[model samples]
Target chain A: MSLARLSRSQQSNRLPELLVPAALGTLMLIYFAVPFVAFLTRAGTTNIITGLSTPEAQVAIRNSLLTAPISTLIATAFGVPLAYVLARASFVGKRLVEALVILPLIVPPVVGGAMILTAVGRFTPIGSAAATLGISLTDSLIGVILAQTFVAAPFVIITARAGFGAIDERLEQASRSLGYGPLSTFWNVSLPLARGAIIAGIILTFARAIGEFGATMMVAYNPRTMPTRIWVDFIAGGMDAIVPVALALLGITLAVLTAVQRFGRVPTVIDR
Target chain B: MILELKQLTHRYGDELAVDDVSFELEEGELLALLGPSGCGKTTIVQAIAGHVQPTAGRVVLRNRDVTEASPEDRHVGIVFQQPTLYPHMTVSENVAYGLTARGVEPNQRDERVSEYLELVDLTEQWDAYPSELSGGQQRRVEVARALAPQPDVLLLDEPLSALDRQLRERLRKEIARIQTETGVTTLFVTHDQQEAMALADRLIVMNDGRVSGSGTPRALYGSPPTPFVASFLGRSNTFPATVVAQQPPTLRVGTHKLTVSNQELSVSAGTSVTCHIRPDGLSVIAPGSENGTALSLAGEVVTVTDVGRRYDVTIRTERSDEFVVETVERPPEPGEEITLELPRDRITIFETHDHDRGSTTGVPEH
Candidate 1:
């Protein structure tokens, strides 16, 4: 009658079998935790405040907040619909479309930037058309947005696709039968059901956009975002300038990551 | 009067899921599509509700063709076996989903939602989320939600099949009461024969994507069209019988000469037929007491089982036909000789050609 008997004894008796794996995992956890702790501690009273007060650091922080989230939002607006389609619709070339969407994540980020340049750069056909409309892709805000979206859209698409796929098809059918139309059903039922997954995807996209380095450097080296500025400071000013900014970025990332982990606890459904 | 399906045929790839199933549902009638799995009962309901496309058919509501219409356009309510209540919504909101989707003003929606909650006897749980309610409560909520809009047609796919036996029986009664009060046309589907018989006014027996028969539960049970309905509705002791002597309501089968009505049979004398006698209709009496008037057979009781309210007695007759009888009173002990009196009117005879055509054997031994 006691349901706890099997799992409790199984875990305890199998402790030796799991020892090496557990220790290795714990070791990795500590290895990562140590640096983060040391960084936060060093920035506790001295370097952290000083790092925040720097003028160049302020601009980098401002640009980082502005461009990364904007691109992330753009990606979300575009990516979520595609994710829903991929998860639900059965059309020809779907697998190919999915492969193409996530292809940027696997290719090197610098190469991704270069590919964007060839396609959308001012001198190329699409870029020339844009230039004809007086828009620029090199060393510009638009270039940064493009680069960030290119690098980070895949994260959102992958996660959103999973989230949408995880929902029961019957739920949507029920919604429709209950008199909700196609769009309203999606807004009221489908969207709310997949909320946690959508939030998780947004957080992942945000993180990728914020941490973007190679593509940012390749496309828009000037009008420096935090990552680009960090690269610049690391090369020119060494650890003195780069360390504090890195710590601040780590703190912000940790806060967002914690929020995501706490609120984005979606139950994994096998059928979906 | 409320719902009609005309030549509704649906196909899934190469196989037909629902084959030319046509039936009309009267208002306030709980019509049960009773069959085993993959028998097209669910497909018929889905087609009527506009959830599935019929390859060749027309679904009519109030004499209007709605076969090509969307589910929303059809305005039919549906309840899945698993309660498809919106988990994020409160009970009231869940019940009001159909109305709210149609842009009903908040005040009217709230009143209707409260009315449905009270009708389902879950008024106190209106504020509760779907996850907070028990399985039975959730199913009731699903029922309430489907009924709130006062849709003409209500489709239920084994709504109570997920509950325990006791709860299922209890809820089945509740559904019958609610359907009576609401006066809506309901198409209920279930593999459970008892559930079908208890709830259905008219039972549509389906098998292999086609309708086997459609009539009142008593009509289907008392004088089933084929051997399938005879055994499906209840227990039947089938024996290979030939018409040694034939009359209007009685047939003589070999030397045993068991009495069976020819109303369900379409065969002539000297033709082999399958005779089915209901276990409850068979009575045990002393041999030769029938005095040539009743069809009596001398048999020995092979097995006697106490089936709660009655004793299930299986008698092996000398003609090799095993007669099963159920009686509340004392039954003959095993190996005891007894005469099973088969009344002339209680037996049904079907042509041997239709015997065992759709009756599935090898159901897991209980």
Candidate 2:
């Protein structure tokens, strides 16, 4: 009986109703695919080699690789524990905490960078305290790291929170009944269960940090990251200098994203 | 006592989840807390396991006042209704969870894990994850894991409630045998009376967040203390009666007179009460063939239902009361006359009272 229904539903295509939506979907695909195709079509090995030979471009690539990963690591260390807490604990200001964590996702990047500047710029009380500890937050690599961390931390929090929330509470209770304390249970059961989501979050944070523009432009532009360098190159030379560096950044993003998507294929309960 | 609950009163705002409930368990005793939902049976189990702290009283385990202890410190194993096997862990690892938590040597953990898995007859499935097993198989895994630690007490919260009928019946017997072999003081919570009666050494029948009745299966079944007990364990034929005589202990039930044993009737003459007769107490005979030895009711067979091994013949008496007689013999056809003989010794009496859910209808149709 279900087979009959399945075949009937399959037979009824609703082609007339789907035509407009299908056209719109194709239009969107074309819209997204065109620019990337144009960039790739214009580039060659010689241009990439030349772009790589430039000292300023090399420094920018090095700077982005260094700071983006640091931001991602810092985001992970803070966000994962916060996500687990948000998933499991019932605190007085839980909703407020969640809204604050999601602040970077909705607020404009330049605005977030400006807020960070006012709070921890070179002359601010906390900023000088940080400088006294050898950590700078304006026109420096540390400034780039802080801005990227602020903008990208929410990605980790939101994704990891979902992952942690999917786990059954019984699993933790079972661990407790089996004589494990809450901290140990979190390490052994909760962490392993949320491994996939954490990796995915890390990938997204790294990508966002690497490609950061408005915030990095606000906090620090001297020790230029990849995005700032690309902007500089685009202004000085035309699309020629922008092309090769952009492709390099795109390459790194693709590698990490692909690795995350492949490596984070966690065996879900359904796989059991 | 291996376990003791002393005046445990757990409240939720103004409502009582467990109101001054107390009980004691001897070593190796399999006690069942049987009740409908919201009856505090699960609360008592949780309190003993240290998952829930009672608002007022203490839970003593092995003579130790472990009221403020954590679940880890209490060393109690729990098996939930939905078998809570760690899905990521294989069966053997799941069984060895408690031992590993205690930092037991790997060699001993493996041996004990295999032993308990074999105990639940799931040795071959040790390499399988929880979701890979069937409902009954998963339940067996849970039982194995709960037993592996060899805890002082085992708490099962409606463990067999989720299985299909056949699986529940088979696992019921399996759990009883396992409990006997392990000899762990087990306090199992269930809403199913039949399952409770079959598995428990003694049953604690709960109602409204307190113990309403408690006794051995035979004792509670033979002499239910209230209307709830009388019907909960199995079906009972109840009749509203007023005491007519105190000296010889007789009751005027409607127009009929029933002579009950004096000890079963505690109320004075002219006081109203409820008389309970087990369905087995009614013996059907051909009409007008009954002797003067027992109370007789002349009735016509209303329905004859073939219930596998026997037939349930429902007879409607002339007084408009219906009684069901379970018999293996050939039952009379519908509309045929029969005599229902009520044996006086099997009758139980209770003070007239109103049940929250049940009707005041003298006879409840089950």
> Candidate 1 — which residues are off by over 4 angstroms?
A1-22, A38-55, A255-272, B243-252, B256-265, B268-271, B352-356, B360-366
lDDT of 1: 0.82
Angstrom error of the Cα, residue B120, model 2: value is 2.4
DockQ, all candidates in order: 0.68, 0.63
Residue-level lDDT tens digits of model 2 in B1-366: 889999999987798899888899999999999988889887888888887889999899999999999888887889988667777789888899889887789989999998999899989997998899999999988888888988888999999888888999999999999998999999989999888988999999888887778999999989887788777777777766799877678888667787776454556899998777777778899977888677788889999999788787888888788777878888889999888888878878787585432322323322
The model with the greatest DockQ is 1
Model 2 reproduces a share of the real contacts of 0.69
Per-residue lDDT of A33-103 in model 2, one digit per residue for the tens? 99878778888533797887799889999999999999999999999999999998988998899999988
Query: How does residue B253 of candidate 2 score in lDDT?
Result: 68
TM-score of each: 0.89, 0.89
